[model samples]
Target: MKQGTGGKIINVASMLSFQGGIRVPSYTASKSGVMGITRLMANEWAKHGINANAIAPGYMATNNTAPIRADEARNRSIQERIPADRWGTPEDLAGPVVFLASQASNYVNGHTLAVDGGWLAR
Candidate 1:
């Protein structure tokens, strides 16, 4: 991007970026840092027409979350907490990712968009 004049930088953050998780102090802190650095990059790179943003996905039924999904009790607890009442799927992120990558989000920068199925709202 720097080699040219403009570009989009989409980073992947996590729900832990916005809140603390059990036994995950380091993970939470690091994801928070991802958000911070994304903002800083936006601040520093905007002049060059670079848009830096992040996506904070909630509980998803992916390889990374296999253990959680396997534990029926924990899975139920999480699903109940989310207004959507289910774990997010990788497919759920398609639209947001597309928007951020497209000119539709030209004015959006340095923001962490949550694809959490209303997890944060609850």
Candidate 2:
């Protein structure tokens, strides 16, 4: 994007970026770094017409979490915490991604939008 002098950069972060989630300290740290770097990029690159942002997705029913979903206890614990009362689907991210990339969110830069089902509110 810097070389091109203008572009949209969308990064994938996680709810862990804001919280010290259980059992995966490294994951939490990595996501936090993603959040920081996204903002740094936005600050430096917005002048070049580059919009750098991140999406912090909550628990989703993707294969990446297949094992956790397979485990009854872990699955129940996560669903209960989410006000949505169910796991999020990949489709849930469609709108947010579109907005970030489209002119609709042109003014939105360096923002890490949490697509959690009110998980952070709890």
Candidate 3:
């Protein structure tokens, strides 16, 4: 990006980055690394007009979580935990994505915005 037109790089992280839950060692480590990398890259490339940031999303009902969502008890448990009273949909994430990709976020860098429906607060 340094040699080309410098732009924004949005890293999609997970809620796991902020807190470690049960039975997911590798996931926790990987997400922690993502937060680190986002900060490092932002600092390194800021002078070149390149912004790097991360978005940490909570439990969303996507293709990757199909198996988990398929189980009745597990799915219910997940929803009950979320303050929003439901799983997040793809549409729930679009606004933040658009803001990050647009000029409105020009001053934002190395920040991890959470779109977790107040999951962290709970």
What's the TM-score of each model vs. the native?
A: 0.95, 0.92, 0.89
How far is each candidate from the true structure, as Cα RMSD in Å? Answer: 1.1, 1.6, 1.6
Q: In model 2, which regions exceed 4 Å deviation? A: 1-5
lDDT tens per residue, model 1, 1-122: 64876999999999899898889889999999999999999999988899999999999889989998999999999899999988999999999999998999999999999999999997
* Total colliding residue pairs, candidate 2: 0
The sequence of per-residue lDDT tens digits that candidate 2 reaches over residues 5-28 is 588899999999999878898899
Ranking by lDDT: 2, 1, 3
Comparison by TM-score, 2 against 3, better one: 2
Model 1 TM-score, all chains together: 0.95
Error of 3 at 63 (Å): 2.7
lDDT of each: 0.93, 0.94, 0.90
lDDT for residue 5 in candidate 3, whole number 0-100:
74
Whole-structure CA lDDT of model 3: 0.90
Quote the positional error of residue 106 for candidate 2 in Å.
0.8
Residue 7 C-alpha lDDT in model 3: 93
